[model samples]
Target: MTDDDRGTRRGEIGPTERLAMNRTGSFDWDLDTGTIDVDEAGLLVFGMGAGAFDGRPATLVQALAPEDRADLDAVIRHAIITGQTSYTAHFRVDMEDGTPQWTHVQARILRKPDGMAHRIVGIVRDTTAEVTHSDFVLELERRREVQTSIVERTTHALSRAVTVDDVTAALTGPGGLARLGADGLALGLVENGSLNLIALSGESLEILDDFRSRRLDRGLPLAEAVLSGRPRFVPAFPALGRDFPELAPYVARMRFRAACYLPLVAQARSLGGMALFYRGRTAFSADERNLALGLAAIVAQSLQRALLFDEERALATGLQETMLPRRIPEITGGEIAVRYHAAWSGRQVGGDWYDVIPLPRGRVGIVVGDVQGHDTHAAAIMGQLRIALRAYAGEGHAPSTVLARASRFLAELDTNRFATCTYAQVDLSGGTVRAVRAGHLDPLIRHTDGRVGRPKLRGGLPLGLATVFGEEEFPETRLDLVPGETLVLHTDGLVEQPGADIEAGLAALADAVRTGPPQAEALADHLSERLWERWGAEDDVALLVLRRSPDPGTPRAPRIHQYIHQADPQGLSDARAAVGQALRDWDMDDLADDAELLTGELLVNVLLHTEGGAVLTLEVLPEPVRRVRLSVQDRSSAWPRRRTPGEAATSGRGLLLLDALSSRWGVEPRGEGKAVWCEIGPVPTPAGAPST
Candidate 1:
């Protein structure tokens, strides 16, 4: 080869020069000796001069910041301890020119026979551009996630807001600010061309109350946004204070660095405005401002929906009240109390209703009913049916005729709706209640005493259903209410509970009634508080309590009454306990057992053989007899006779129990019923008690 060709070959670049030109460097670290050897490229990557490095690990480490140096040491130690074959790390080195240069490192760990690291061969490269790009991408992703979370959670929460108050509570309640990703929040509504602040969320943001009600002037950023339907962002507190001096005090107390005000615009009009303040951020990026605007749009939609719901609900409630009776008439011989509750779902309007109408000759007709559904149509049908039913009863029709005609009336409307009702014609002068049931719950009678009973009245199908089924016969049940007795008529909502048997609800109602005050208004209130409120008032309820005027009889002739339901397990025991207590009070304690036993026997006979229930009355005979008389009355007219049964027979033992326990027992005819009577006392009076 010629001299020129050989010179050109020697000047050609090798692989080592190529790697150095790519900013890649190499190092040989003798781990055992704690010494390192670095190439020129590595020294350049570390921002160290040849004179500054002395072939030791500290020489290169000195070029790194203290935190980066510690981090690199930790990476090496962790790799050796975990028996790794290689290690990788990224860090920043301080350069001679006082600028930070990002560097990436890769090393190969070589171990001895005992598995201790002997040497590390590694490479270093300047990674400034790559790391900067990666960091930018990561930050963008973080912002996107935060903005997405704010929109998603806020939308889900506002979806269930049914009223304006609900929307307000959702935004200001616990965890609201944190979920909204704001250090502080302010909300205001547009009312009468002015902004009325309704919500302020933060630890000390209530200090902003001075500008709570302000005009749409540019002096306040939020008001200005609402006026123009635009958003304003203040990236620093200085700008905030300079723009609105009134907000300076609150901004100081809020300890916020940045803020954004957004207008809540829906369909070309502003409904409200919202303000978000940040303690950590000093500048608002375009992405951040756009996120605030999107949140404001979501809030605007929720507010619009809630306003519409409130408007429609008010209209429906007004319609419901207008259809009901203007005022309940005062009956001559009784005091009446009524209660009504609307459900909490949607609009709070339903088909439940109650009415009281005055009839001929001191008779009052009371009705409690429920149309089929909960919408406005059902309520409309209920109004028409109530008026028609009242007309029939006021015309002096029988209770049965009133309900039957009402059924036909409902069916003639030709709507796909049915109604269940219990109607009663109460003759207060004679203390008589004639009631008819149309696929509704039976009426309950609370005795002069504390015991409560339900009478089994036969019922036809529901109103429209009865007519559709070609049968409209509603049987009447005749019940004689003694003076001071309370008759209760209520819709099913009063005693209905979710996921539970209807029987359990009825038992609870009876217990609440039995232990409650005897006054009509007080009893109705008690039932409402105990049952309806406890059940969440998920359905509409209508309740009526009518208390016959008290007849304070002669003191010596005081009396007690109780009704025993056939389906009640506690009925027999309750009746027994009541009778025994009465006998003790009348100074006839010696006959308590016999009186209790006879009372149970007669009640059992009526309950077992009859389809309905029975009423037990215990009276102290006035004057010289000094005897307690007990009578058990039921709707069945078949007189109970003597029955001979074998020892093993369980049947016909009720009459035998009565025969064995009573002093003298006889059956007498009552109003469409039969009464069994027995006497218990004439006992030696209590030692020091006066005999009447």
Candidate 2:
């Protein structure tokens, strides 16, 4: 090489060599001659014999593995041609023993004074162990961070899951298995000590479905995990051929060589197992195993909680249904409809009941009551109270008498819970109603024209507080139901919301009832839906509606109509029943006993003094004159006559008894028979009746 080409910078090569002498190796390359000179350590790093390498650039390049030779040569040529300051590269070289060793090379060009390319001076170091260790650590850290994030997100999802299906989706959905690097997932719950596959993801579903149908016991990774309460890891699919040869096709189709079965254990109890699949054999790290175990624990706990809630809610629903009446009494002259809405709190039962009892003499008893509690105990008490009320009312007691007796019955039981109730007796024939309240909301009356009114009732103490006394009796309120008017009785749950004005809810309820559909059924349904949509009160609600419409032939709302036959002495009984029914329909059930007596007297006179069967007809006069007219016709020309009974004269005093019991009595002679008629009063003096 020429002097200038030798380079003044190259004169300091001795100092550069001394600096690169320890640990690392040093080398010099003449670009013009394409010759290389390496120290002993440099030759060792390049995988060349101590004195075997000639001073040739090709020889040095040939020592490096083929994969790295071209890139290293290009870097060296560029540095020399452009007089680049420095360049570094890592490459591999094959040792004499055929073992590959990794090396790092750093080169700097020694330029001439004219700034032309001259010689290249460089150092070489063996970094095979350090590079391999660093890459392995970095990869492990990346995997750990990824798995930690996935586990955290999965736990959050599981926490929000409130049902079994939600739990399954969180464990096997796209957000779950994919993040965990699983190819397919199968979740098997340990129910009744058996592993039953409930959810699956990816291609494993078909295989898992077949496996579940087989009902195999033992020899399965999932079963083993659940039975042992530990995780089972299968490193390779072929390794399972001996134990589970049936899974070969599944493994092949899913391209699965590795799998993990983890038991979902919580509080030391094994609830289920989770199966994870991978495309190739995987050596699970301790971190991965621990992460999976934690995930299983969270899933197990969430599933257990959701399952328990479902069971409790079902039980509560059953109890509540049994406590409420299934059907209302089918009566005439009016229509009765009932509705019940349950509380929203899970597994919590409320004490709300509605009943319709058809009593003797055609009087109907309607009750809406609420027992204080939010559990099974309340439901039980409500059922008992409902039965007691029905029994008392059916025994021919008046509305106030029935409620007072019910209150006494509750007090005798000494149950800590109290109850509010409203009892109403509707007289279909009399067109009158009597209601008594025991610490309950007053009944609402909705007129056909959309006006609503609630009477100012005096409330008594709630049942279970004390025995009913003369002064403490539930105060009675009487109403003359106008045609097309409805009486609404509801439990407090319908109008009471938590931390809100109760009066507002009551006004809303009254408005809904007044403006609802005219038909009883449609009105009841509409009011219930309105309550649910407006406040969604979390308490149970019970509504009972009784509507009295205009005359039957006018095409108004639904009403009841019944007929009975009259024959001999049975005819007298039938006559009483017919009048009683009419009286009850008219809401004058209080006058049923007297009316029945008058009808019985007339029917008996026909059966005893006349020759043929009698036909009894009972009818009601609406609004302006609320009266029940009872008439019995017999095929006899003899008309009834008033006679003064001689104490022992049971046969001749029929007309006298009818005259004394009824507001009006008369006998009209027909062509073939004589008709005896008696009429009961238009109850509640006209001056006392509410204005339309």
Candidate 3:
């Protein structure tokens, strides 16, 4: 070809020849001559020898394999007619040795001055190795992507496993073992230094269940795997019976031939081991082993977290139960019913508590309070605050003062949390209730006529808020509980559901109170069940119901009465026996020891000081408030007085001892003698005004 015909081509001028010479091979085509010229390397790519054939377009076309010749010719013809700048083709070529390999040809069309194709310059190379290597890399990349997906799904599924059953389900269920290329799984946990099977799945499940309640000894393969904190694999697991004859029975039932035992270890602690099984012999690959180890680790972490959460939840529930009052005391004029519901989803214990403290003068102090959080911290704070409120109320503080003291108590702890509380004192005899609020929901009042409404009460800031800013004031709201009226006190959890309007919850609560059963116990149960069904508690709920009891037709005598003769030391013993019996009759055996001691002291005082006979009386008053009153009436008019006796002096310390043992004591003038009476109970305010 002439230099003008080949070198003057526009698209394939500079660097084309140099590039082709160094890497592939170059070819020059003269459209006018209708022939092509191939370099030495280009001839090798096409399996041709020098001068073996003329470089005609038809001859070059014959070199391409049959399947590629037509398409390559079509492109060359299009390039010549349209003046296309570049064209590329990949096809198979036959070598002289009868071997087939892939070849790639890239060519540029050289246009003449009139925009017509003058010549073609091209580069050619055998790309069989590159294509094969690219396909291999693509396969490896796809497999890696699949493995990553499996890991992500395994972790995601295990994340919500809160129990052994949940973990087992995630492991062998649809996407778990199958995705990980396993057919079955067994999970064994270390309990009391022994490996115990707690969960099993898949076709090999029966083999694991055979030892479900039994501990695997050190000789067992599973136990050894966990103890060593290493992975173990068996291509034919059924053959294990030959080494350990004791496992022959379980091996006979196993459906899987291959198995892998991976330790479930976290933070250097071996919590358990996971067993993966396959129906056919599996020579475990590195990727398979790695996936098993990773899955085991994830399972260990999830299981450990769930177990700790359950432990904490159980502890919190126990504490809450222990902190709550065991039973509601039967008051003289009213009955108290209480219900406590913890959140169903989380910690199971929350910061809601209710208490009924019997005040002086036949009055009952009712309290409902809620701390800020739903965790153990909040429950602990609730406990402390509940006890403090009870102590303050028992000291005979008014509703307002009691709450004020409680607020200060919580604020002083510096826990950075707040509480809302309501404290109410119900005088059953007077049918009056005085209540004070500390940023708490209003109390619901149900009238005797079946009408219910929330009582409007002025409230101060929540407990810790005022202390952070300044002093706080609690306002009181007083109302009379008519004959059949009942008061409902509760934490906000009862009336405030998640994302619902507070007013709506309040109205619903009021409606439930009005339409529920009339009796305190039944009404309390009804409201609890209904409210919980309507709106599951996301927080803790504390509900207290106090209702006036119907008047009894006749008055009942004191629980115990006795007459003691002069010079009768047996009277003291008899008095103690009576107190014990009375306490037992009240189902209060827990108080027998204290009651007996106090009764003995009073009777001894009567026997030591008085010469004449005395009347002993023990009575439990459940109206207006609940209290156990013991009185000693003697013919002697001498009244008993409290005195600070010397430590060594025992004779003059009876009254002093009585004053310390009893909640309150006084001397009263009777028709024929003087009566010394003392009260022991949750009876209101030991420091406030005495009973009228």
Candidate 4:
């Protein structure tokens, strides 16, 4: 065909058909009637003769290489049998020089109405360079998969470790290290200008340490690779055999003919290097080098995290030691024991503290308090408050008064912090304890008889309330403690904790004391253990136990006397005789009858109005006072009212009799049982008022 005919045929086709004809430079083929159509680029690619040739029409199989002829035939046959319009394939074609070149063939079959293909029109393009480039990319991708698998397996095994030793064992143990295809491996950490042997896979620690202790020159293969921020592999040691003879023994012992050293870099900092040894003289592929670097990075990060944790624990422990009080003072007439326990195995240093201050008049002030946070600031605030409270108590103030002053001091101090505190003063001489509570746990009093009692006291607001001019009313409460009674004061951290109800914790503490040993040390230890067991030790705890000393003057099982009398004067005389006989029966012959006359007058008033006679009960309690209470009940639905002496007639003489004979008196209503009580002080006798 002429060039004009070819141009006309190409113009009649679509844009895709026109471009397909123009891109035929990489192939040689016959067009139309078996005439060779060879462009200049196509002639250069095939290196074949370029002349018009007269021959039969060339079939699609004519361009296929000898080895790919069968595949090309199969594709053509399928297209013809299925009446497919076209078939395409990638195959190699034999060139004129007997060399093979890759080619892509696309064949179009033309069929008649008889279902038989008579003509096959196709295009062939050489793709030798493209196919070679594509095969290289596929090979690299497969190698990447192998490298990723190795890194994933190693990291998964290492993450299961709970301790540093476990991590090292997992990284260096036989199965774990061999899986990475290293004949022997050494982990070196940068220390003192030389690599310190942290771990090794197939070498003794002594050998590794000795080798690492030698000065690692910066230009050494492993050291240079780390410093240059790239991996280096020594394919053979023969090149450096003469320069570094000392490495010959290590190389032979480790069976390493080839070695790859990778730097452990994390966050732009070089930690050390990991040396992977190979038994054969084999070089690492790019994928193997990447895997080595990735594993080294993971090791560096994990080691850094462990070191940081240890440093944090050291700091927390040091802060706790400085925060807690070093010693507590020895109290006179009382045995004081204190125990402070910080929470176990955590970084929090809580703000629980206790203090004991000696006050004037043979009294000791005790305090247990907790600030509102769990850090250094909380602890510092606790110390400041403790010092301020002690200073106030030392100034001869009552327990309630001391707390009020301390609250004001905290409110006006530099810090606007608040604290819950329990302040108590034990009067050794009087056998009484006065206390004030400021939003704190109530201290428990364990009697010598094994009975526990919580003293009645109204709790005030915590410190720092005075900033708003909010007055903190500290209710002063007094309790007469018997000899051998024990008092326990503690912060809420001792009994209150996370995941535990406060009431349950309190009950647990009480049960521990009830069932455990009785000594102060034993009791504190048992209660602390019970608390930690239930609550898991989430906060700091402080405890103080005070055991009251036995008093020599206290009576044991003193006698009690009751007298009932009518309203008549004869009954009053009879009441006087009952009092004298009771005192004498208790071995007290020094009793005077004048004190009994005052008691009889108060009882006669109740008998005159009520259907039942009056009841007068007297008992000797512990130290300082012998109590005598007179209860007068009447059926009248009227309450007692105090009256002026000038306004009332002779009927007011009953109250005057109570006021004259009793040290204190009060009236209280008890569910239709109204009682007017009169307490008489111990009378002065020759033998120190019968020892009260």
Taken over the whole model, the C-alpha lDDT of each candidate is 0.83, 0.74, 0.77, 0.66
| Steric clashes per prediction | 0, 16, 11, 0
Q: How does candidate 4 fare on TM-score?
A: 0.47
Q: Which candidate should be chosen as best, given TM-score against the real structure?
A: 1
TM-scores, all models, native as reference: 0.74, 0.53, 0.54, 0.47
- Candidate 2: Cα lDDT at 609: 77
Across residues 1-692, which tens digit of lDDT does each residue of candidate 1 receive?
86556655999666677778988899999988888999999889998777878888887778788888899899989999999999999999878899888999999999999998899999999998888899999999998999899889888888988788888887888777776788889999999878999889876677888888888677888988888887888888656767788766566676788888899988887798999888899888888888888888989999998888878778777777787887888877689999887776657578888999998888899999999998889899999999999999989999888888898999899999999999988888656687888889887888776668787776789998998998889887767677788888988888887897888888888888888888888988998899897653778889999999886644455577677888998989998998888777766677788888787778888888899888888776644666777888987879987878898987777767766766667776553477788876565544554666
Name model 3 segments beyond 4 Å from true.
Answer: 1-82, 92-100, 108-124, 150-184, 197-207, 218-221, 235-258, 277-281, 327-351, 356-366, 371-419, 423-436, 443-455, 458-489, 492-692
For residues 407-514, what per-residue lDDT tens digits would candidate 4 score against the true structure?
A: 888887767568888888887544467778888888887756565655545568887674345776887665545556678888887777777689887787776666
**Candidate 1 residue 249 C-alpha distance from true site, Å:** 7.1
Two-way TM-score contest, 2 vs 3, winner: 3
RMSD of 2: 17.1
Residue pairs with clashing backbones, model 1? none
Model with the higher TM-score, candidate 3 or 4: 3
Q: After superposition, how far is residue 163 of candidate 1 from its true place, in Å?
A: 1.7
RMSD of each: 7.1, 17.1, 20.1, 14.6
